[model samples]
Target: MSEKKYSEKHEWVELNGDIATVGITKHATEQLGDIVFTEVPEKGKSFEAGGEAAVVESVKAASDVYSPIAGEVTESNDAIVGDPSLVNQDPEGNGWFFKIKVSDVNQISNLMNKSDYDKFVTESA
Candidate 1:
């Protein structure tokens, strides 16, 4: 599989075939250090673009997790619910939050690839 793509809002999506794994980016986790709790969506629930899909709570703040694409949640990382710091530890790997069966593949085209995401992050800094 290829490295994940990212959104301007600090979310990442990794596509393996039609299923997409979604999570907050490293920058996001760093901004919300020491995550303590997570409110994840129930598997099988569908959410539209920009819809609230989950919540990540850190000692510093609680942030809403938005859906980068419209899709049905297929699975969630229960490990993060028990140990939210997993996100703070590895935002791109063991820290992933959920998986979704994507509905609109074309939405993938609108997201930033690694290079573009890097540029966006740098400019926003």
Candidate 2:
């Protein structure tokens, strides 16, 4: 029952009930160009919308990954940390960053759907 959504900052989330699996979008990874390292947030950590939740380092630059909605991190993807190339290889799939138990599911209404996000990306470019 998860519906995938995207944020303006180039992150995507798949919300299922109270849990959301989050990660950078494919466009984001392409922009980053060969990710070298990543730091997933610790479990049990709570963050507000727009707060820094993780970090990603690529050949271009190091960037902070922001939380698109308020939630408590329930799980972190250790596989991506062990092999960062997974991010570039599969940004929307196995490369997912973390899972959060959202505090308010309604907060996601502010984000974009695939069609809107595609237009937004195109227009922004």
Candidate 3:
């Protein structure tokens, strides 16, 4: 597993070679409250860095999940669509929204590391 990269919008990406697994941060899930619904992107759909890639709704509100890096979605996790609580239970694990075939691996460098993201969340809160 590679080091996870984070976006200011609270999405995280862990790349393994050219494929990147994307998901919301645990902090994001906490802020969203109990997750109720999720809509993952379709396979083969391409997105630019920061593009809206998925939709997640909690009891509190609905939010768009963005791709931290430009890529073509290669897989979507249906488990979260069936049981949205999975995101709340494990936001950074099995709850991952999708995997993408990265269009530019270099884009990963533009995102924050875990420590930086933790600090960002702290200061922003």
- Name the candidate that leads on lDDT: 3
lDDT by residue for model 1 (5-118), tens: 899889999988778999999888888888999988899999997789999999978889998988999999999998888899999899988899999877888899989998
Question: In TM-score terms, which candidate is top?
Answer: 3
| Local distance difference test values of all predictions, in order | 0.89, 0.95, 0.96
What's the CA error at residue 13 for candidate 2, in Å? Answer: 0.7
Model 3: worst 10 consecutive residues (lDDT sum): 59-68
Q: Candidate 3: which stretches are off by over 4 Å?
A: none
Per-residue lDDT of 108 in model 3:
96
- Angstrom error at residue 70, model 2: 0.5
For residue 36, what is the lDDT in candidate 1? 95
- TM-score, predicted candidate 1 vs. hidden true structure: 0.95
Q: Score every model by TM-score.
A: 0.95, 0.98, 0.98
Clashing pairs in 1: none
Question: Clashes in model 2: which pairs?
Answer: none
RMSD of each: 1.0, 0.6, 0.5
